[model samples]
Target: MVTSATQVLFPERIYQCEANIQLIAAHPEQGCYVVTDRTPFHPVSHIWPDHPADRGTVVLESQVHEVVDCLVGAVEQESGQLYVGADIPVKRDEPGWVFVVVHHLAESIESSVGTKATLNVDEQYQLALSRGHSGGHLSSLALNKVLHHDFWRKDASRKDELGHYDFHSYAQTESRVTEDCSTDTYRIGKTLRKRGLNAADMIAALPTIADQINQQLAAWCEAGFPVDMRREGEALTDSRYWRCDLQEGVVVEIPCGGTHVTSLAEYAALRVEFQLINEQELVMITHSQPA
Candidate 1:
């Protein structure tokens, strides 16, 4: 059964942890091992998954095992059953379930069940993904500002921190963040139209909207706004907000659960392009230049 208390080690930085490892099980068919306690690797979240897992290696008993994949694993409360990644049954932060990071080793180590092991995360890849995630957030806010004028009614309510109608959050159907950029898909269906959004007019003015977004992004990057993650607690399930300090003391806050650069100055430039995927769907692709 999954225990009530579990520890995480990635909140500060990704590195190798020299802690004792308990080999919970060995998948003979898959040639992988599962361990408990201490890992600097960040596993992909089962719910609201955006960023991918970290790649790295684990060492035990003089055997170096390449960690080909990392995933989130949960143990059952009553049945003592263990589930990994997409096989997880319940949502994250669910009560009576213990969450652990599972590092999929390339080969089985010589160590026994209770032997000590070390974990080492690939730092270069993690940094790239962090920059991409930050750029993704900035691009989304810029797009919201550019499309602010498309909302026909002032009484429709529900605007973003920048006073836009918040079409990014409201109309978005799926969002994915990659190593270089982020892709967001939105549905411009009847619900959005009923809320006083004119999709046809917005699509016709796509060029102007794109220009506006690019201009805003350029200004933000030039200003070198400070960015940080505000967390409610130190735990894995704690609520976190991505805070960006813009010009004129304006701060934008959005809920997020991912790593990012310390400041906007790290980005040399940022740009976004909009494309119409279908009659009632839109795609926004964000690009970031490394500093």
Candidate 2:
């Protein structure tokens, strides 16, 4: 009965939905974990962990439960064994695994398996994250364009959608999204040098590069380019893409699962600062404040 509704079939895509409670279990360390037949919660990805989990309230009957953390959980096809987050042994979409979003609650409830529940995400927090994520993508593209004419190996096979050398894609190590900003780090070590990037030149031009990136981002915001999210299906494992038409006459499509603002118009200003550390590590800090 907890799994009856069609919406529960792909809870991750539901965003906001009312669904039956499928299962409730006690966790040894993380408190109570609730699995609804359907939900709108965005669980922390075990693979990427970039966008952070969605925070929301789960209302059951008249009592509301605060979802402290949302996480990805998978059950084995043959054994029905459950693994959460880092405990999983295989990659996502692995054969014979059922993926589900697990909402962490502080206390266990005595509700029955088919109890109806409502999922509501905090709008303010979601909006901040959306702006941050969108700005992060924009800043990456701008960074690539700023460094396009120099420092890249002419024969570098990778290129951005706008024909610029894809420095962001090639050198990016880790990216993390915060309230109004995203920080990305890159390593310009021996491997990057071998790939035709002039690391010395990049380090020397850090300030100029930052200015160029900020200018490009400001122009993009002024143009108010359209941003769209493309979903292949409603399932958690389905492919999704963030597509944007830039003022620079380039249509960029990047595979992304996180949420984003509807357009560049939502941002008043988008700026990026660059820092070169240890003569080999490059850090790009992007900040976005919504209008």
Best by lDDT: 2
Show pairs that collide, candidate 1. Answer: 1-80
lDDT string, candidate 1, 1-291, tens digits: 234323555656656688566446565466675665677787777787888888888877777788877777776777666687778887767877766677777765556655677878888787777788888888878887777766455445777777777888778988887876888898989888888787788888888888898999899998888887787765566677888888634688888877777788988988889889787999988888878
**What TM-score fits each model?**
0.89, 0.92
Error of 2 at 60 (Å): 0.8
Clashes of each: 1, 2
Global CA lDDT computed for model 1: 0.76
Give Cα distance to truth, residue 24, candidate 2, Å.
Answer: 1.7
Query: Residue 175: error of model 1 in Å?
Result: 1.3
